[model samples]
Target chain A: MDYSKMCPKFESAAELLGKKWTGLIIRVLMGGPKRFKDIKEQIPDMSDKMLTDRMKELESLGVVKRTVYPEMPVRIEYELTEKGRDLEEVTNSIQAWGEKWM
Target chain B: MDYSKMCPKFESAAELLGKKWTGLIIRVLMGGPKRFKDIKEQIPDMSDKMLTDRMKELESLGVVKRTVYPEMPVRIEYELTEKGRDLEEVTNSIQAWGEKWM
Candidate 1:
């Protein structure tokens, strides 16, 4: 196979998705928008610092949207954008593979 | 959502796939077994050492298999195991997503 002809977009996507803790964070958010604490609670093994970093990265990539709801106490939530929501297939496939193999 | 109920298998799978270059390497091998030089040539940005390390890691995880063929000159090849071939869905999904978004 002429791998040199491989798509650059797929390469970029692979690099982005393959980052440490990024996939898990995205998977957690796939449930719906949640507060910072809530997201942290889901992936117990990940450090708060790591979660924060991944969240920021995802947000910057337009895969996640950070919203601050202002009331008496501001409620900040992280939700997937349309682009991120499109990743459901990717994550779900991983989950399926993991169940069978991992 | 009860984040505590998240599947550990999924988490482990995410971590493994999310490793840098692992996804790309798997995608390359998806074509078929290839020589080390062929694989390296496909992904220009990756260093030789990094590719070696990732290959070893994937082999250890049972995702990749290394075989040596005896001939006039030694022939070595790397190929995906059943487990690795199963990741086509995961990689294809990522490719689809990348085509649409990235």
Candidate 2:
């Protein structure tokens, strides 16, 4: 229990998840894949530019996978990768805590 | 599974925990009550001013309790309230994910 030294892994994880709107974005995706508009609709307060930025960040981190369907009007969708799905525990815990306390 | 509407409780919890250094500070305090110096020492990159600000924020949120023991020289300690301790699940989930992925 003596956490005299900070753990780098935890620090990195915290940094990734601690980004504004990152957790909620992940939470939204937890339900399943969705179009850009769907994701945007869920988080009304987040600007389009911010959502774009966070999505790209998550995509780069391999937490999210963006797929483009080559149709008349290109269909774009976002979904969680396995790694992203792994965060269910983290999100679920947060939800539980939030419901009880926040 | 349809999270069409964002949960206010989850949003509030995410906002609180997403703040920089907040999770790490809580993680450090998870060991037990520690003096300000101890907390700062664990998170070496955080400035004194930042730590002061975060501690005050956490205290005001009722997630942290600050105690002062009157002596020749006053001794102070920071500990998690029951509400704060409840965050163990959240922190632990993050730690587990970090170790596996981050």
Model 2: per-residue Cα lDDT over A1-102, one tens digit each = 346678999999999999999999999999899998998888989999999999999999999999999998999999999999999999999999999998
Clashing residue pairs found in predicted model 1:
A18-B18
Using lDDT as the measure, the top candidate is 2
Error of 1 at A12 (Å): 0.9
TM-score of each candidate structure, all chains considered together: 0.94, 0.97
Best candidate, TM-score: 2
lDDT of 1: 0.88
TM-score of chain B of each: 0.92, 0.96
lDDT of 1 at A32: 90
Give the worst 10-residue stretch by lDDT in candidate 1 chain B.
B1-10
TM-score for chain A as predicted in candidate 2: 0.96
